[model samples]
Target: MTKESMMLPARTYSVSIDRDWRALYEEIWQPEYFTKWASGLAESDLRADGDGWLADGPEGPIRIRFTPHNDYGVMDHFVDADTGSEVHIPLRVVQNGDGAEVMLTLYRQPGMSDEKFAADAKWINGDLKALKALFTPQRGRNG
Candidate 1:
């Protein structure tokens, strides 16, 4: 591979939500809702920035541009750092039986240690769990 072209190691993590695929995508495809579960992307505030958004990440403030709403369940977004580093996050919701499956692909950047990658995977899984919890049925004592 050329120095300018690099392919990073990647992994796709998914969660199953007991909701209709199209309905689930329609409800959660907005960038605003992303902050609710995608902790890795937003630690707190995520405000609009024209076509994209300005969010508070762990390192610092980052710019995120999300794909326009589509008929297909594609919520891909690009996170841009101040240092010119950009991370492509491909998120999707697809039909699984009567429920829906949400998927996020995480890529291990150059110089990222295996331990860090593993931790990132764990973090992604946790985020996916949080997303799943949004649709999971809650049992209250009153019920």
Candidate 2:
């Protein structure tokens, strides 16, 4: 069956980062950088193969296909979870004044309990904070 056929209810969460949109996009919009901030792949090694990316997921190895970078700030991806199901992640980065706002949409799939969904949301929030920290200025750094 097609991955889209298994989609579930989605919830969106966003975080603002004080950095240039283009710079942020260039830095983290690729598959190679996903492991840096995404909690799901935190323990996995990600690599770009052909049209998609290969990585070690929580259950096992998986493949992820991401939308190409565009002017509209879409950074969505389809991840083949170990359950043999494909999960769609919708992400975006839009210009917010002199900075950028990153948004991530999480889908609550079938069989997922309320607590699991809440935990997932918290995890995403932490990941977004980590992303913002990447560009944050250090106390000793000269701007």
Candidate 3:
């Protein structure tokens, strides 16, 4: 790899959720749930439009196109940041033991600072935690 490529390696993060891969995929991989758990859309409103969805991004209104759910658990998407730039996010859910692991692979774009990358990683971690908590069973009142 070139020195420049080495400096901007793809970052991957995964979280193990105590749920079936299919179940989790069905529950979380939807346009309605983007704002619910996705860090990038935390403050965005995603709504279905003609072919894709319209979303409010950090810059401004953005267009989002998501890959259809498949048996292989590939849930990738593209977000148009309104600057003639489109970012492709690769995500997957792989079966792991009794549960499943949700993995997100993020590519470090050119000119991205180390601090910004760290912050993005932290944000992804928080989103994964929130996803896990959403599926975790609640304790009983008397217990």
C-alpha lDDT values of all predictions: 0.89, 0.87, 0.83
In candidate 3 the C-alpha lDDT for residue 68 amounts to 89
Model 3 / residue 52 / CA error / Å: 1.8
True lDDT of residue 63, candidate 3: 94
TM per model?
Answer: 0.90, 0.85, 0.86
Can you write out model 1's per-residue Cα lDDT over 1-143, one digit (the tens) per residue? 79647777899999999999999999998889988888866466888989889988887888999999999899999999776978898999999999899999999988899999999899999999999988888889998
Q: How many backbone clashes are present in model 3?
A: 0
Candidate with maximal TM-score: 1
What tens-digit string does per-residue lDDT give for candidate 2 at 89-121? 899999999989999999997899999999999
Tell me which of candidates 1 and 3 scores higher on TM-score.
1
Clashes of each: 0, 0, 0
Q: Which has the higher lDDT value, candidate number 2 or candidate number 3?
A: 2
Model 2: CA > 4 A from native: 1-7, 140-143
Number of the top candidate by lDDT?
1
List pairs with backbone clashes in candidate 1.
none
Task: Estimate the Cα RMSD of every predicted model relative to the unseen true structure.
Answer: 2.4, 3.9, 2.6
